[model samples]
Target: MNYINKITLLFLLSISVSFAQEKLSKEDAINLALENNYGIKIADSNLKIAKNNKSILNSGYLPTLTGNAGATYNKDNTEAIFANNEVSILKGAKSNRFNASLNLNYTLFDGLGRLYNYKQLKEQYNLTELQARETIEKTLLQLFTVYYKVALLTENVALLTQSLKISKDRLTRVNYQFEYGQNTKLFILNAEVDVNNDSIALLNTNQLLLNAKRDLYVVLGKKENPNFYVDTQVNFLTKLNKQELFGQVKTNNVSLLQIQRGIEISSFQLKANKSGYLPTIGLTTTYGWSKSNNNSASFLLESTNTGLSTGFNFKWDLFNSGRTRTQIQNAKINYDIQQLSKQQKELEITRDFNNAWEEYKTKLFIFQTQEKNVETNKRNFSRTEEQFKLGQITSIEFRQAQVNLLNAQSNLNSAKYDAKNTELKLLQLTGDLLNTEF
Candidate 1:
């Protein structure tokens, strides 16, 4: 095996019970999450509602249509009053009335309030659609982060298994050496402790990896799931600059987009509130038909009345206890606050990007230094082992060299995965990670 391969195989044999590779790429995970995640579903449902409600504002422009029918019977000992100065007193009277009408009322104009509302709702629907897109991006980002983490942890567990195997072999060697008076009891004890430490570390990493995998599956909304394995051989170097990355992040970060939508919605609402000051003009028309039969004195009379009337209506809130004005002011304040929130979110994104970038760079340097350290430690241990085998060095000195080699290998593996993770975090923060393909 090549040096890296040898070290990897050894570490994995020492740390894991089994090592298997099953790969799911970043794109696949993100697409699945966006399609199935709960947050995305909620956003989609709300978008549907928004679309259904948007046209309600236009209903005011449509004519109001109504129909009615009724019949009544009455009797009285009465006197009736008439418009023509004619009145009658009767011993008994009975009346039957029947009426029916179909009416239509179209608002010829409504102070343009209805028009404003229709425009506003259409814009509101667009805003809701933008919100849904925001949710999708967020879910995708989260999915990528979890998926990559699981991948890194799985690699760690495999490497640690290899380490455990080497420890076991070393333990056997130590016992043989002691029986021949070539090693001490303390040497055997150190070997056993290293093996135990490797076992414990393996357990912890395995559990963490399992949790990450399960979390990803749950986010994908899968009720039944397959064991996840991720590709760890990804190249960390890429062509991404802060400016381009930041631009993409600002566009794709859904929370920030949602806040921007809130600002727009609130602005329109403020405009709607101020509409109360505008004169509202309306056209109204009424049509009626009625028929009645009267029984008074000795004779019965039937009468029918039908009329259609149309008129203009105007409502100007010339003055009210400042209700509309206060509402407008409050809406403006809300709009301003939303804008401020959006600005704050932008600053936070910048900070997050910077932190992740620094971490990745720091880990990358550590990984490089540790890589050389492992190779040098292996060479030194080999020379020291030769010296001890020739009886020029004590058993303890030889064992310490072996221990240093093992520790160096462990450190190198850890730094490799840590650097990868930090790079992943940087990509995630900048919203570029979701687009990352294996």
Candidate 2:
């Protein structure tokens, strides 16, 4: 067995090993991210907290009930002189008292502040939901970016592997021709140099492939490098319409929705602040009982009392040193800020969508052009190979054709993945990424 045969055998063994590793599909990768990614988990927890906050209790709609009880004991010696010139002396005087009360208070009105607060909480919950979704959209975008990158590198490695095989074959032919006195030592040296160059390229690409796979593992929340292979097929959505995408962006963009929710929340805050100017009316009810016992008393040694009372209370903040006025003013200003922010965000999203749309179109076009270029290079390399075997073409020309074919294939691979990434971005901008079937 020769050196080339050994190299080929080793390459085949490695390929077989790679094939034995588990194939992680794109859908599986996405599902794993959703299930286990830390960012997604944190977002989900925050969303749950927001959901839990949306309750009447948090809005102050419920009444407050409280109970109190106490007991006291006293011991003392007393000497008392009566008005009839009689002296009465009492020793070891003892007294005990017990008291208990239950009080209930309910706010009947506060300029509808409770209602506005509840609405605010609802809006906050909605905002949190949108924020979580945005997190998901961003995470999915990152995932796909890395996923396609791995795919590109995977295909590049394959192409380099094939290129290396061609170089090695050319070197073997050169060696045979040199042994038969048909080729010069310079030709054999050139062929050997090309083989080494191809080997280096393949090694470097394999390293990139490894690093990309590691990134994929991290995104999937895997603690270890699983050394798994990814599906190189990147699916692209080519029929996306600009007008339809813009429509979706206006209505469904997560960031836009969050801003709209912020506007509503600010509106509620303004209303709540305005409520502070009006009188607060409430109902209060109380039930009480008390008992007392005294030893060494002539007449009224024991006493007990019980009572129930109910009343309505009203309080108007006639003036708070302009505090309420200041709060209302601030709330109004915040509401205006939110409105302006919404407008700005709308413009920004529209611009991003436009850029991504144009990029997708351009990348797709480049991909098509590269596809044709690769086919042409492949045919040209085939004819060059035949001519070189017939001694009609120089080794340098043959090497140039080989390099051209390799580069064309590499460019095609890169363009394909780049176009796919742009497509994903468009989907994300339109809020259709999560809903679109992969």
Candidate 3:
């Protein structure tokens, strides 16, 4: 009674756990990644930096003010002469003074460096945003892969377990017959071996499930949050065919957007470099006060006053050892590299679409064919067992029949999973996997 109660309790607990595991949805996974993924964090930090740079770039357009203060003491020993050239004895004297002034500086111009820098920063902002999207897509891809793998493994373990139960029932019947001297012992041994193998497979599957769960935590960016359970509700998105998959890749693929942003950034860099050749002009202003003490009577000798002035300045780089030309060349080279990368990416995407399409077709065929194979094998195994009971088939033959049935079932499961994975991959390749309908 105690063993039976414990078993029942364990079964109930397992069911509750499964229900809990299934509660996580795809949207939950995406939101978790966006909030916690390391890549997304880095991208967000870069965006902050770009915004700060943009703000600093505009500072040159504003005026700057400064204040100053000082205190000094001076000692002098000298003789004073009368108007008639009569000399008198000299004495040492010290004078103390205090002074302060305020000055302001404003840029008249700097060859438009400020404007170009601002433009560059703006472009960088776009790049950082694209980078964030890239991280998001990559994170999503990893989540999809791990989640489906876990789901497939879980289903497989369940199927195999059901198979083991059926095999166990057959073994029990065979044992009953053997006690009556109506069945061979070899049949029992074979069943035992098969059950042992199935147990081993189940153990391995469980380990894999654990590993997949750990990966899920990583993809969700929750290394420190162990108590957070994942939602594993999954559905194979259907209604996607090769016909419409590729059509969306160019428009919706995050990688393609990043490539386009790269192009825009390179264009802006080129423009910035070209602007260096032109002269920069700007306006400036300075206001301050001054005073001087040149004699012992410092309080009587002074020129204390304040004034304000405004003027413009121009700077032209006439000769710079071809630095501007070199910079322009560098910019052009970077542009060429980006363009080439875009072309290469296009080709790679095309190849991916073609491969995914062919794979989808292959899996579909296998899925259809395996269904018939499972049905046929099911009948064959059952008939072979009846023949063994009548002493018409050898134990070896019956064991082979069992193996065939198991293999068929395994293959059929594999085919189903393959079909699902290929279909999802094809949609992703065509850049429409995450569309609202899917």
Among the numbered candidates, top TM-score falls to 2
Give the TM-score of each candidate: 0.75, 0.94, 0.81
C-alpha local distance difference test of each model: 0.74, 0.89, 0.71
lDDT of 3 by residue, 1-438 (tens): 553234435445644666655445667777788898888889889888877877864646777778888877777776767677877554666555666766667666665666666776777787787677666656677777776766666666676666656566666777887899986788788766666665566556656766777788888888752222343333455565565667787776667777877887787788778877988775656666666565643336655657787777787888789999899999999999999999999888888888888888889889889989999999998899889778787666876887788888878777876777677677666555556432
Q: Given candidate 2, what's the lDDT at residue 85?
A: 75
Candidate maximizing lDDT = 2
Which residue pairs clash in candidate 3? 24-231, 108-281, 108-282, 108-283, 109-281, 109-282, 111-280, 245-430
What lDDT score is found at residue 142 in candidate 1? Answer: 67
lDDT of 2: 0.89
Total clashing pairs for each candidate: 21, 0, 8
* Model 3 worst lDDT run, 10 consecutive residues: 225-234
- Model 3 residue-pair collision total: 8
- Model 3 spans with C-alpha error above 4 angstroms: 1-22, 56-60, 73-92, 96-104, 224-238, 241-244, 290-299, 375-402, 433-438
Question: How far off is residue 363 in model 2, in Å?
Answer: 0.8
Model 1: per-residue Cα lDDT at residue 179: 99
